[model samples]
Target: MLQSSVTPHPERDRLMTRTRRIASRLRDLRSAAGTLPDAVVLLDHSQHVRWFNHAAEELLGLKRPRDRGRLMSDLLRHTELAPWWIDGAREPLNDVTAPGHPNRHVTATLLPFGSRQRLLLARDTSHLTRLEQIRRDFVANVSHELRTPLTVIHGYLELLDPEDVPELAPVLDEMRAQSKRMGQIVEDLLTLSRLETQDHVADEHVQMVPLLASLRKEAEALSQGRHTVTLDVVAPIDLLGSPKDLHSAFSNLVSNAVRYTPTGGRIAIRWAPSESDGATFSVQDSGFGIPAAHIARLTERFYRVSSSRSRDSGGTGLGLSIVKHVLNLHQARLAIESEPGKGSTFACVFGPDRLLRGTQAAEAAAAGVPY
Candidate 1:
């Protein structure tokens, strides 16, 4: 390999030496808050613009090197952003002009260079806007999802005053189950948010016996008289991360299997040393498997492969999202394999180091998960 040597310039050296002090003085004089948004621009005495930053290229979708030395008019040629270079107005413009329609919003403003030239500072707000839209859609989806269940529960209650609806007891019970599922979803959402906002790292070691036991118990209860849940291993499994995080992750996977699998179907939880430097906990079930096209998006928040079935099965739709995030916190990862009409397998692959060493082995063996 050949190495190239860089030579230093005296004049450039002096300029670099004084650059910081100059920038500091300029920022102190300006009232701009926080860090100025990063952007790129070009300008000359007349209407020419040279080049700018990578952010500028992305936001404006223009090639800098190719468009350099081009006229500002040719660059923003047909857009309202072109007139933003004219002298006199320093105020920001919030315009989105089209053939006849225009958008309204203000976020960034343009500024002059030295004496005559100027540059436009446009911040990329598209991501933020998309996030807002997702938030809106999620709320609407959740509300729409819960509406039917809520209505059914309400209708059942109204039609059968507990004492009067002795004949409709079964329907009332079903209504109550749906209402409770919705409630569980709401609660899980809160838990997900709280976990994400926390700074919990996967390095936090947690005693796994009780947590896993409780999770298995919860799964069994949810399974009720459906599948016979079985634990493939014993635990006191000292998970090398937050007990809460691991439990939540495993619980979601197991819960989903139990929820979707038909009655009398077998649900198995297996834990064992998996490969070098890792342990694996897998949840297997004889449930309705996911279609090939939908497997990739199964973890997406609120993304349900089977809308009507998701409703019938009473899923809050945030279960996998929670599992995904919780595993991220534990430094573990999820691997899903499924065949439509068969069943699915969700494996929580934890790093071997995250497993308890020495006497902790006994703990893990004793605390094995209940499949």
Candidate 2:
């Protein structure tokens, strides 16, 4: 060969230095992984274990040589975890307990990286879960204890005669109203507790016409000639759900519309099929609408957009939360649309899976027919 290597490349030294720095950084990262608190695992697109940190070995019970290249499902065998792992869930799984460590609760999250690699992180949530359980228990116990006493007070207040005590008539009337409001709140709390504790609802074909008629009557009574209430039934499809739960959800929305809308305001209740073959029962109102800020927390228990206004309107403030729970049991959702001064529309949109098409009489006789 000819003598062509007389001069070295000018950038050869700089390239070598950069490569050495990169290698050093990678080594440092590997060392840091050994001391992390949360379990960390790296997986390929096929869900095969690429590597795991020291915390993973301790928390997840994953061993280096034995678990490497194995499928993640092969190690964690919880039935509830199978769906999230296989479906490549975008949302993080909360309150998930690994099969081996049933008592140790962990929240698992996945982060995608480097074109086919994924990083799985498991954070211990045992303490937080315990606190949540404590809160629920406290609320349930307090609500149950207050129910009998509240009923007694309400009954006694009802028995109080304004004629017998004419001097304190206005005060007694006010006391009765306040006691009645308290009773309503206590009842709603108990209902909420029962719903949270109960599992799935016993399904049946609920007659829509009768339910709607009942709701209309309630709205009229609540309105007391102050609001113009109208019912528009475009589709006569019965729902496959618990009649009691459905009635509660619908009536809550209707009564809220009646309560909030000003005198002579129009409240339209409509039932129709949605674009997705599902059905929608919506209560549109011309009322003092909700602010954008309050809309997000409208379904939260005891949350009031305007505290004074809600109290004046005799609202228990648990109506939307109850509606939310009922719709959740039926695999449906509430859609609330509003503007500050214009009006509000509360729509309970049921998925196609929950709707039963045909005559109400046929559906009721059939019990529950799939559409």
Candidate 3:
């Protein structure tokens, strides 16, 4: 259709004519990109393909000497690009899968040349598409998990008869506790998801003294009669980051310490700045510590060391997972120290670059990094 009566260019009009010729190469053809020869392909009467690049052969398996003189549709008729060859555009595409390259997606822009010339631009977006799919799937799975417990609680309550089940009080109490645990788990999952997706997080200068005092108070409140915690500040630390985020992070670790420690066991919160050059906060506890075999999976969603024990202790199984995500967001790191019978310590290590001084923090703000 493009190969109509188009006039040939005059010899004196080389620069103007060629630039205009390329500028007019706007055909909405999807069958584009991957120039095997890098030479021009004359699609219609007066318009030629100005150039092609190397990706053509690998992506589409097209070659110049072999494919030249052929109609454009004949060369790309079997591809996802085919629909665009006949029509200028195709309807919005789902993933455009090729036989040899399964689960692949590509994009192209069209250009017009003379009456009917078109240029194809292409890129592989398969990896990005797959990742988005996975994120969606994860979100769905979490939603389903959260809904199950609520459903069970609703069903059980609907069947409850107070007069007939007066002796079932303890069972109902357990049900209520389990429902609360499920709610806690769901909340933690949402929190972890937010932390993972957040574009920016402030890690500000947090002084050690006040943080220790606050943490001690919180630990004492959480420990109650389970264990008495002793506060220990090793290296009087000054950290640069969001104090609130750090507070939550250390709170989670220290709360875990208080919750898991046996009666009369020691729980300690400590801060140290390493010449190895970073800041570290550790919450250590003489609890019924985790076994060597089960440490690595402590951060996985819903993973637990002992299901019954964790349930009895009201563990949501997402505390450490939250810790990991929070630390990673600030470009900080994590370490877990434990012995099966002794105790466990959860520590977060911050790089020296992140531990900026008050002046440096101010300078960074002025310089546009904003800490």
The prediction achieving the highest lDDT against the true structure is 2
Which ranges of candidate 1 are over 4 A from the true structure?
Answer: 1-126, 129-161, 165-175, 202-204, 234-237, 360-371
| Residue 181 local lDDT, model 2 | 89
* Alpha carbon lDDT at 178, candidate 1: 66
- State residue 41's C-alpha deviation in candidate 2, in Å: 3.4
Winning candidate number (TM-score): 2
Candidate lDDT values, in order: 0.70, 0.87, 0.69
TM-score of each: 0.55, 0.87, 0.57
Arranged by lDDT, best first: 2, 1, 3
lDDT of 1 by residue, 1-371 (tens): 97769876999989987998899886774424223454456567775766566655655555747877887667665655656645434677543332112332224466778878787666655456557557756765676677677667666565666566688778777777766776677667666666655656645456555555676788889978777887766444556666666777888888889888999898888877676768788989888898889988988888998889888877889999888888877767889999988999999888866788657656555666321
The whole-model C-alpha lDDT of candidate 2 against the native structure comes to 0.87
Name the lDDT of candidate 1.
0.70
lDDT of 3 at 146: 76
Which stretches of candidate 2 lie above 4 Å from their native place? 1-13, 31-35, 54-63, 71-78, 86-88, 359-364, 367-371
Going through the candidates in the order shown, the clash numbers are: 16, 0, 17
Q: Write the per-residue lDDT of candidate 3 for residues 1-371, one digit (tens) a residue.
A: 57768677677579887777766664312134333322123455432334454565444445656655556666667887777656854443344654246556655445556666665545566777889768956975776677776867757775776568889877876776677667676777677777766756775556657878899999888878668778777655466667777777888898888877888889988777765778788888888888878888888877988888777778888888888878877778788878987999888888887675557655655665521
